[model samples]
Target: MFEPEKQLVGEWVLDVRPEEVRVLVSGFQSWSEAELRPLTDLQAVPMMKWRHEQGHDPAFLPSGEAGVWRSHTLLALVRPDGSGWVGCAVDAAHTFTHWEARVDGQQVRVTCTSEGPAVEVAWQDTADVIGTLETLSAQLGRNMNAITPTPLRVWCSWYSYYRDVTLENMLDNARLARQHSLPFDVFQLDDGFQADLGDWFEPSSHFGGHASELPAQLDALGFTPGIWLAPFLASPTSKLFRDHSDWMLRGEDGQPLPVGNNWGGPYYTLDTTHPEVLNWLRELSATVRGWGYTYLKLDFLYGAALPGVRHDPSIGRAQAYRNAMQALRDGAPDAFILACGAPLAGSIGLVDAMRTGPDVAPYWDEESRRVWLGDATGPSARNALHTALSRWYQHSWYQPDPDVAIVRRELSLLNHHERGSIAGMLDIIGGLRASSDPISMLDEEGLALLHRCLQISTPDRPTTLAQSFGGAVTHFSRGTFNLTNQSVTNLPAHAYLEQRL
Candidate 1:
């Protein structure tokens, strides 16, 4: 409920309608606008703004247009007469162009009944005015909290290549984990299980002809068996691709889309919108479940949300992902879902856990640069700290995976201080991942660091707080903090005390 004349300066309310959502940015009058400016700007707004600004370029060209910059925010009102008002605004230029929204007293809500993409309603409330804009686009998803009674746990994915891991190796590792008494509930088998990624069902020769037994072995060891599967992607040589070439995403020229270089040569993105594809995925999930696997890590999920495709854009990217997630849930109702490379907001209320950072490494260097850098002048742990801080609320509401905690390993090319810094940050944030293969060539000190990290628990909020370059780290009363080093080279780190502020 809202009072027409009441000033909404410190708090705001958001309500969604069937066609559009009304975001009332109250809490400010003319005199208080100055104070609110810092919170609303992208560079200064902290967590919320940091998440919103992802994938956006300062200079962007909108779809179906060129040369001119796309409107930072576009608003339009369509009436039954087929003629209505259109508005646009550029926050960078401090200009509001073609702005028009029906204002009811001090409240304004924009309605879009058009044939374009789903509509987005954005507003910045100031002391004097409530800046509002609505764009015809997709509706985003919200991050949902994890199931109750499940205490936050940390575990790691097994990159076999990194440590020559095998089923026997995993069993040995599990034995070590049990002996070390590390707090980890799941152990993920990453990237080396299938004969090849393209052939999802075929087990690699190294699996000893009994890949299915790995889960039970883990179960006997008191750990859950988690396997990595990219549901939307298929290798170019995959049998599914051979059987249904048309099932993959197509370019404007109707050619099969390239899967990109990160995974392999070229693969296809499954059209999740197609009923057959959904059915296939459901069956695949059922098969995986039949093998006793209880957890599934869905990676490279962003590719499934591309616009202007066969999907129903009216439902928005978030909803499309929700649908896919629902399909996965229907197939494996009891399995835990770990979503990665997807928008955090869009995954709200859907996934059981999410990867908040790219990948993290044991040290800072060129090989590790993709996930995190080691340079003090760069973002390093500093950026990761901000990310962890901003997403702290998720721990109370949902499971937050600050990526993997790479414990010190002999094979790992990181130094002692670097390992200490990484360990300290993981301890503070209380993330849910750890990787220390038994056969991997790690020393006692490295294993000790990992054992210490696994003992840390997730916090409701971070303790030591610092913010820069759209990132942050919040330390907790438990002497742990969540750190995010977003820059390619710079890493940030913060210390935490075991007492509440």
Candidate 2:
């Protein structure tokens, strides 16, 4: 039991509720950066790569020295023998649970705050790290009863064509997919489809008034037509923004709250609490589904949950986000809702699949930290694998999408070993298998490699660290892989290793 009289640093106060005494744990190990590394202990390394993405789940970020660390919804501090405290807010549906940990040698102080609804943290003490996490995963899923959609091999157009994707590009890829006998169930048109972010009904000039026609064409060719859009976002130039300014979430200045910089400038969020905005979301989703596109890859969905003035102030951020997701579900009842860049706790049972990590780039590691300040939540294969492995237990909540595996040789910067490592990681931590390579550009070797990736059928299980050697090369079961560029060959089960790409 915690002795507040001796351990309390200062006065602990609650903003939403009156002060109440709750003593949870006692005798935590000396807190250091090494003590906090996600799955291993690297005492020599002072800094750790903590992930802070808008829609991604919060993973462990162990600090060697004293610093400020934060996690959303859940947090756990486990030792080599698996003795520690695991705390999670059961009321995440009503409010956002933010955890901040401050480490000082032997004593690690933690503070949890929520925007609304009184926080009720559920704490557990465990000697088995893996079992505790699995139990926690089931506990979170009790109310969700999430539906895992049928495993799908998908072909996407984003990585190859990006915003320059023309309808011709999609058709050509579809042809190659059929000719190569690729087992792709969904042919997803990512981004680039809408004339603007919020205006999903209008197609860009690249479609040539054939956006609706393309979906039917793909359907006739035995593909589930899919499309990507940021439904909660409205670009400044979008017709939706110009027509209904009142529908946008605003800041304290009474101006539209800018969510993030994208599409050449900043974009704003739609106030999901607004009755008309919810109606529009329902209508938008219905319209997209009506076009023979049953698979909806909703991207950049963090917009709806951003801090701003919502039309309804009684509910918190998580509730607001769930409300919007509910509207989309109501509209596209039968469509496959793949939630990308979405809040982990808020989207439970609402989406068929969830992107478990950040976007995967053609490269192995990210070079620059100037823009994102060393956050590992950016688009890199190494980044994706790190977070995905850390949160591998989430498969019970929904189908975990580890993002697309880029195996094709051409139009990519990844070398032989780098590409192979990506494929290996994706195969071991399986969920949705997707490729964005323009197949026609690939040679026989690349095509064969892509074929192998699509055929991998690994059972989803909790990835536990077997051992840790200064965070160098991490190993996994079914196959051994690495987090650092260092290579790791065949290793025994439950043997932890690390290697950088």
Of the candidates shown, which would achieve the greatest lDDT relative to the real structure? Answer: 2
Model 2 C-alpha lDDT per residue in residues 165-266, reported as the tens digit of each score: 888888889988999999999999988877888888888877655568789779877899998978999999999999999999888788887766657877
lDDT of 1 by residue, 262-380 (tens): 44355567766777877877877777888888888777675554432453324443355556766777888888777776544445555677665545554453324223322111123
Would you list the C-alpha lDDT of every candidate in the order shown? 0.46, 0.65
lDDT of 2 at 481: 48
How well does candidate 2 match the true structure in TM-score terms? 0.83
- What are the C-alpha RMSDs, in order, of all predicted structures? 12.4, 7.8
Write down the TM-score for model 1.
Answer: 0.65
Worst ten in a row by lDDT for model 1: 27-36
